[model samples]
Target: MRVTMIGTGYVGLVSGACFADFGHVVTCVDKDPSKIERLERGEIPIFEPGLDDLVAKNVKAGRLSFTLDGAEAIRDAEVVFIAVGTPTRRGDGHADLSYVYAAAEEIASLIDGFTVVVTKSTVPVGTGDEVEAIMRRVRPDGEFAVVSNPEFLREGAAIEDFKRPDRVVIGTEDPRARAVMGELYRPLSLSDFPVVYTARRTSELIKYAGNAFLAMKITFINEMADLCEKVGADVQQVAKGIGLDGRIGSKFLHAGPGYGGSCFPKDTIALVRTAQQYGAPVRLIETTVEVNDARKKVMAKRVEAVIGDLAGKTIGILGLTFKPNTDDMRDSPSLDIIPALQAMGAKVKAFDPEGMREAAHLFTDLELVDGPYEVAQGADALVLLTEWDQFRALDLAQIKNRMNQPVLIDLRNIYKPAEARAAGFLYSSIGRA
Candidate 1:
């Protein structure tokens, strides 16, 4: 299949590259000249594990290409995917669909023959109908089927997820569109991955509902961690004991600062706004959003409880990205916790293998050092914000000797309490008494 993907952002780029690797001819289009130029020059604009090599391999095989103008590509393609960003709208909290609508209009004008237009971006329910209406308004006689096909790719492991998805949800009633989508994902279908064909609205709701549930799960475990701490219990063992049950398998059960990333924060708020607009509210999700926000704000107080006074103290931060393998800093917990520590009069020096470049733009007066040991040197306390693989097995004794005070606050609970205590350091962790 010949496919044209609009927007070349994280979703667009990753999906387009993966589709090209599946032996489809793909042209990724973007309005930004710099982004297209960078892609064309073999320089990836984002930090995703193995994405650079995947893009390079597919491009070398003549299956993937990048462009600024998509007119010719759209006219020749059998499938046109709108993979643009649907960020949360300001004030309204609904998904901002201007970019999706704009792409639909452009595709409507350029498509020559019958085309299957798929919305691969995470969007609110009923967005497919609005996109179809917009396309019809632009080209009344155009023979195109607008379908909803939301992506569920995780940032760090997008390629693996795309290749071996838990399930593929395709939303369309048109037989031709269904056939086209089926052929597009034939590789997965052949590998026995379930492809669910459902109504467009249901498909859209599935994306939001899935994300909201995961966010709730993370929040639930976090609340349990708090209770465990007060009641002299360990959250890790608690998570392990319950996770062995088949009904509630352990996935997002780790107790951390909170859930913060591109999807959960924006999607949960959008779902709340959508439900209220329909006269049906999800109070649990509303509470989840509230609790997660409050959790990130008070994480600095945990440090204060240990060190007594943060005034004129130097703190060392281990990680800055939301997760380890991706350099995405959107709504990361560090964004909240770092500033709160600074406001309480503690200067912070941080290090992350991949996130420092992006983190530099989000923080001010932040000392971004070259290595973890540099962050530990002369610091009053060492805090592990994100559990990068390198930070897991650091020389605890060396770090203890380098710091002004041998204090370790493991926010992600990466270290065992007894080990830190035996290393002659004042240790504190989440949900372990």
Candidate 2:
């Protein structure tokens, strides 16, 4: 199948690249000229494991290419995928669908015929109808079917997840559109990945509900960690016990500062707003969002508790990205914690293997170091916000010696309290006594 993927953000780029790797001809379309130029030059804008290699190989094989002109990409494509961003709108918490709408309008003017236009971006319920309406309003003469096809790839493991997704959801009423989408993903049809065909609204809701549930799980564990600390229990042990049950999976059960990345924070908020507008309040999700937001600063305070206060302190942050193996800093917990630390007069130095360059733009005031030890050197306390592999098994004694005060706050609970105590450092962490 010849496919045109609109937008080149994380989901768009990954999905487009993986589709090409599936032996389909793919043309990635982006409005951003610079991003398209970078892709043309074989420069991947975002960092995802194995993405560069995948894009390069596919491009070299002539199965994949990129362009700034959306019309050109969509000209002869059998499937036109709208993978544009739906960021949280300012002050409303609803998904800002302007980009998606804009793409739809542009696609409206150039709808050839019998093309299956799939919404691969996470969108609000009824967005398929909106896209359909936009197409009709603009073109008023051509026939194109809009289908809902949301993405569910996590940042760090996007490549693996895309190649072997558990299921693929396609929401469309048109049998022709369904057949087209099915044929487009026919390569994955042999991979035994279930293709769920459902109503458009249900598919859209699935994306939001899935993200909300994951965000809630993370918040639940984080709150449990706090309770465990107060009640003289270990949250890790608690998580393990609960996670043993097949009903409650162990993934996302780790107690960290909070769930922050490109998806959860904004997605949860958008879901809450959607529920409110429709008069169905999701109280659990509401509290989860509130708790997660507070948890970030509380993490900084957790570090401050170990360091006595932030005033005149030099604190080293071990990781800046929300999670490992990606350079995305959107809605990262570090964005909140670092600023809170700086507010209290702490000099913050940070390091992330991939996120430093992106995070550097967000944090012009902080000193970004090249490595873990560099950030730790001469600091009063070292705070591990994102658990990068490099920070996991460092020489604890060497790190202890580098700090002005031998203190470490493991926000991700990467280190045991006993282990830190044995290393002769004052260590404090979430969910452990």
The TM-score that candidate 1 achieves is 0.99
Q: What TM-score would candidate 2 get against the native? A: 0.98
RMSD of candidate 1 to the true fold?
Answer: 0.6
Q: What is the lDDT, from 0 to 100, of the residue 116 in candidate 1?
A: 94
**RMSD to true structure for each model, in Å:** 0.6, 1.0
- The candidate scoring highest on TM-score is 1
Estimate, for each residue in 179-276, the C-alpha lDDT of model 2 and write its tens digit: 99889888888888899999999999999999999999999999999999999999999999999999998988999988888889888999999899
Cα error of candidate 1 at position 96, Å: 1.0
**Worst-scoring 10-residue span by lDDT in model 2:** 298-307
- Which segments of model 1 are wrong by more than 4 Å? none
Candidates' C-alpha lDDT: 0.95, 0.89
